[model samples]
Target: MIPRHFKLLLLGAAICAPIFSSAQKIKAPLPNWQNLDLKADGQFGISTEKAYNELLKGKKHVPVVVAVLDAGVDIKHEDLKKIMWVNPKETAANTTDDDKNGYADDVHGWSFLGSAKGSIQYDNLELVRQIRLGQAKFADPKNIAPTDKEAYKAYQKMVAELQGKIDKAKESSNNMLNVALKFNSMVSKMGSRNPSKKQFADYSPEDPAETQLQKIALENWGTGDFNNFMEEEIYGAMKHYREQLDYHFNINFDSRDTVGDNYADVNERNYGTGDAAGPAPDHGSHVAGIIAAVRDNDLGIKGVADDVAIMSVRTVPNGDERDKDVANAIRYAAANGAKVINMSFGKGYSSNKTAVDDAVKFAMSKDVLIVHSAGNDGKDNDKEPGFPNKFYEDKSGEAAAWIEIGASGYIDDETLAAPFSNYGKNTVDVYAPGVKINSTMPGSKYKEQDGTSMSAPVVSGLAALIRSYYPKLTALQVKEILMKSAVKVDHKVTVKNGDGKRKVLFSDICQTGGIVNAYEALKLAATY
Candidate 1:
């Protein structure tokens, strides 16, 4: 699946490296800024502290289950172990289906990306998969049948887009190589020594290009060793681009056999393993911590919701997620007792939209609230629709219990909207604090990350908070209260639009024209 945060990291290293070279150093935002209020703490947080102090001081609450449908989670994490969902009927690590629910020993949740043998970490993008499946039938225009005209046209478009991506990857790879070479040459000319910032500033360059390169090295690399920077950051990015060409965009690359399921079947539910913590649980673990890490444990950062259970449904891999796995994951969560599902992963294309739509409908029928990240492409989602959206493909209706979120920074001026967040006035419901958010990571550690991936969990945690306190309200009612009680931004904010930045009113980009405020939402929930 496409983790929005990871995609932004690749973009920064690949496409925006040049701009970053000339950029000034930015001060890191204060930790736990996402819970602080703007008026009370001078940060554009969700006012969670205010809600806890003034609204929910002595309130009794039930535990709400929030299903994280993404790249798996570390279920045994120190900060997350006690808050994880446990199957009451099934036992952990047993080879039998104790609960009689078709899955064997699904203690926490299920992993649709794994099998009895191992798990699938990397796979081709959905676009590449489409091209690979259709090449034999639509490779040549002369062999196209009249019934396949539209399909053939779409196939051609996929080819063109794939080629464009390949070309860009190659170009970025070449740029990074050139930069590495320049750094090496500068080092050689300076008697083969990794210089400090003062040394770099004092050294004279023979040419203007070398001078520019030296300035970039000083500003971006700081006093770090040039060799390590080249190996870890520069060459590492080059290797990533190479992988994109060889694996992500490669039509011949397929990893579905690892899952050992019938690839053509859209409704196969008996496959996959019971291990929710797959090979990589970094992204999912961070997301879970943001939602339901134990509060006041004095061990790690507190979560948005105090009383909640995190259910891990691993459907995402290193690449784009399949529609079948996503649909099954949603069904699994809904069939169980997950009142809210947080989807922090998305892609641009959906080969099987009907399956996902039906699963979403199933979740809705079960009174489950689904929250999705808008995306990190910095484009208007209304123009370029993202998958797992609220709209159904059959032109029937939209989901009433869905909340699409965009990322907002801690500042309220030109930097209010996160530069990488995708926005749409009719698509994105609200914004949340996502910039420099510190949370639990794998290996009992913690780190800061930024994206709409981070933003969705903020809203999800808020939703769980509301559901825990107001158990009588339906999922649709919670969605309404969150949207209606959001903190509206009347001033203009600067947002990224493709290659440039533009100033627009917050209302012009999101449906609520504001950020999600927990205090206001809980206050509004009390009335309901």
Candidate 2:
């Protein structure tokens, strides 16, 4: 589970009333449009196919390892199994630390959210954790020490924000329940669980109550099969809101005991199990697929890089990821020979940012490139930077091998930038095809997701592609080539600015002011 705002953006649809049915027929874009070129296919994409055909044709490339640091990954998925990184020293399920790297049976990768018993599926948000700790430390706000004044002030603000979130979650959950009940009643009256749009429109009520339900359905849903709208969307939103109250915003909720690690020890790295594919592998699997899912398999969608191995490093949970786990995951990946790392998860706060920064420096020292999502808050990253970013907490220096990616759509007009994608002229490095990106899911399934989560992997895949063909180029050089070789978009594009949309030149919002192009980057890589 990402932040609520990020999850909503990844869903690619609003969960509020007057919800539009995904079942509504609409003309779909060309299959694998993210790899198609704008000039050749009339779709705004990264031109991956063109790169493979023209630039990388018949090229003997080394296998580049891309570490996917997210919730988890489906290592057994048809499209991903063949390309998963296997630990050469550690054997699978033998309960032995063959590699002697403090991890046992890490055949694929490691799961920082797991333990010898099981894995954590959900956890409290960072805000909740902060409040929980603050309330204990500063029980008497009036007797705060002079040095604790600022900490107490921030705690008070967090308390207020947590209250607001609780209220909103309760209201949304109630609304969903009411809407679900009404839809169920309407279905009961119709004597059909799966009624067509015409059937719903032609419904005749036998009583005033039923008539009122019919009117509400028509007003909220408009048209389409009510079952899918109610079951998938409504119930899903209801569950999300319920989780927000039960886990995310709940100060008493603590799942750290399951992991059996010292909660206060930010430097502890010898904990967790080797189950990289935890209880929830959907998000990570999709991200891995976007990066490298066996391109020539012809089973699912083709990934951006053909000769790459995906290393699963499970760090994120259903709620906000802890900075300690993120730090450990980065170190683990960098030490395990990952040339590129994709971090598709982020939060607004970090409890131990220094640990993460140190880990980032370690990765940098190892010449590994990290690609991170710019976030889905639609806010300027310059104003509200995401956690575990390139900037070190102490501001000594920034990571040279970092790429911040924003989401873009498959369009060349004003809608090119994804409305939910976060951007900044000095923060976001480039944009990538993210809207309606189809990728591999858990259980050998596939899904089309939207968000900067999807976009970051696009850039990561490109980085892996460059690293595969030109292993001599440094991570910083690859980052520069990717940014400088982006396809410049001079026209203005519509973007979300608070509650309203605004049109701005693409160059004004991001450093490159353009979307990433694989063809151009590969061409530049050859020159390097």
Candidate 3:
């Protein structure tokens, strides 16, 4: 079981850190990192290209369905449209559940964030919601029963910590927005849409404010080019702040109403609409592309797997995904013949962990492998409970089909571990290339996104490849083989430690102590 102090450590680290590695610097926007050979590039990449060229040169494998439970995928994405999974039994726009599986018109996959009316865009974090619901009863410890006393204490602690985080997020958002506004005004007045530092270096501003703004821009933006500094750094920071204020820290918002389901009842089914791609499709689309963007299409980037069908399970929202939605998404994927499920979203708190556990069990029963991101808290997950984990909070074994993944960088340097990746020798199974990962975005766009969110799908894509080629391997077997076949590295590494950096053995972070390798995994699969 995770110690009580471990949970507190998670809260502290999560509050201090950004959701993804802010230290992630934009390199050449390319897709080679995810498939780079370790020996050639001095990277911890999965050797996806090598696997395709050598191990899987003449292999003809069956198509495998991979469920992506994320903020919602753009099923109509140019590179993803043809490779997306379509329910053969369900008819589109027919006003009937033709599949007879409690879902109607689930052509690509089901959307659990919506109802007949519309879809949700925002929601309260589970910690905030829990505090609000139990605040009155736990106001005074004197009235609480003995059995409920521990829970009451936990509620109080969580309330205090989460509230602090919300306050900090609000302050950060205000500061970033203010800076962004100032920069925007300065840029507009400068007359050049894409002005460079060299252009500003020669100018002398009459206004004091203009002088100050110019100085600020030169100091920060001069080091990097103007376009990159604005679009990659400042704009990215603004988006992060906006998401924090409008979604993660919003307490009064309730998206469940849009879903029109009793969130308390995990048994509730078929309460969502047909729009699998919710209001946001960027995150999920990016994830989908990492797993199975159309290969050899001369498109933006080729995915790791060639003949894989991406099942778009839209369960995640702008904020934390509810346990009910997650449970339903897993079961839906399992029932619909998905060999693997990639969950790129996770929360620190779970209101109904048992519900998710039961669903995981159901998925495992149907031989569905689950791949999850270890989170970006920069804390040890063996001690902290990242919800939807391989084991329950009580330390009881839950699912053998699950693979907990941590993010790694392409280069083999001191900053090998992605600055934001959560790791644990016992909890995380393997590491994957995540930093500055270029993949498909919504509206036929392509962008570089960094996070464990990207790493999980890299493994998911590999898992699909293995399962497709070796159809006889069970979910548990695949999980084990992936772990055992990982390219182990025996060296000390530097990882994030809240405010400071810490050096630790690579083995201390993840069980494999190395990076996931598609070539190695395929070779092992052949043996199986």
Candidate 4:
């Protein structure tokens, strides 16, 4: 069980490096692209300009509705204001559930974290609870012995898995410390209060000054674009280093063991209360701005969809999301008329698989499309699975609306697929621009970020584009169109391995092996 206290700390932030693709060399650029994040660039407006010039002039489809499920959105964001999804049944700012669905004045969406206030949510909250319960069940020393031997073996396996996480956390913390120390030393040697790369690089490579600086730059921070160095980037390493140290060395992370309450108790619909101000609204607001923040408004940034509306459902807090909350969020999006849903989060453990899967099934039944981020752990998803997968092992369903996307970059062929993006031909469906992605932050600010979290919203905008222009297609069909029409890359790319090394020929990581092209998807949809 992921404890409540830990959950409060968990919700947050991916890195992308270049990888090899089957396409041996970059001869031609992928053409007819559409959908640049509004928060990213005024250039993204060029993509929208193309959409209008080529596709939108003659189109008459209704505006699309996309739901962003993450931290709460800054409802006051200028770009996000007009398009906010209002519950028609209830009056805004009034203390009545005019819709009478138990939730009061849920004009935009409901916040689940406030109700489960103290409890922390982890990926396998339920699974952890089960393991704990089994341990408590038999006080007898004889009970400790495996009855069928198989029983003892199962327990052993579970224990080993939990122990693996403990090991990894420790390892990660150590690595961060090593990296952080290197950076600290680099700063000390330069003696420059704030050493930008240029000042540091004024020395020659053969010179001890340059050699040491280059090695330090590569080892500590990953890149050396001095001009583009984010405030978050320079300090993020220090932050990561400290946070990991606490996670591993500290005895208490209260969020670690919270899998209590009958998660399966579906009859109890009053799962959470009405505190919409989630612990962190950063990721959620960033996602929300991507899909439907009004474009060409000269505000912080433009969103992908023009006439679309946004449904903000604050479910994720600082850590892993509760199964009950996730499931309910899905149903809420579907019931509230959201045509598309974007989920930019995932965890390895899902204690209440039954509830989680049920929510997915319900979404599919309602024909609502879901876009998910392939986790940022950088391991091949095929070898390391993340929870809330799009397809069941059986592969029985012909049409699955859920999509798992990896990160891409606006850089050249060399930096195409980010080294950190999770890939698996069977698991990751596609890729999108995630490296140095610019989007809306809380407090109505515009900022740059990196992660599959950014990637999911880029595609969500495209999904909204397709659905907006072609409403006739069902959610399942739209998902298929997006995948099937994706521009596949034949380049043999380079990707980072589970160990911090690089590996080649990782093109097969994603089924599509291509960055999404909205223009192509829309063109394909027209035919369908």
Against the reference, the lDDT scores of all candidates come to 0.87, 0.86, 0.80, 0.64
For candidate 4, write residues 377-469 as lDDT tens digits.
677888878776765534555227888888876543545676667778788898887765557776777765667887888889888888888
Residue 75 of model 2: what lDDT?
89
Could you tell me the TM-score of candidate 2?
0.92
Alpha-carbon deviation at 124 in model 1, angstroms: 1.2
What is candidate 1's CA lDDT for residue 108? Answer: 92
Q: Candidate 3 residues 18-42, lDDT tens each?
A: 3322223444423568888878665
The worst-scoring run of ten residues by lDDT in candidate 3 lies at 1-10
Model 1 segments more than 4 A misplaced: 1-21, 24-27, 180-236
Model 4 has a clash total of 37
Q: How high is each candidate's TM-score?
A: 0.91, 0.92, 0.88, 0.77
Clashes of 1: 0
Predicted structure 3, TM vs. truth:
0.88
Q: Candidate 1, residues 1-528: lDDT per residue as tens digits?
A: 444335324533533354433444555566688998899888889999899999998899999999999888998888999999999999888789999988998999999998976998888888898888889787688978899999998888999999998998788777877877876787787775666567667779886667667665554452257765565566767777777888888888888899999978998998898888899898899999999888888988889999998999998887899999999999999999999999998988888999999999999999999999998888899899988899999999999999999999998787789888899999999999888788888788887778898999999999999999999999999999999999999999888777788999999999999999999999999998
lDDT of 1 at 122: 83
Model 2 CA lDDT for position 183: 67
> On a 0 to 1 TM-score scale, where does candidate 1 land against the true structure?
0.91
Worst 10 residues of 2 by lDDT: 7-16
The residue ranges of model 2 lying beyond 4 angstroms of the native Cα positions read: 4-27, 196-229
Give the number of the best model, judged by TM-score: 2
As for lDDT, the candidate ahead, 3 or 4, is 3
**Which portions of model 4 show Cα errors greater than 4 Å?**
1-49, 92-95, 116-142, 145-231, 234-267, 274-277, 392-399, 412-414, 497-507
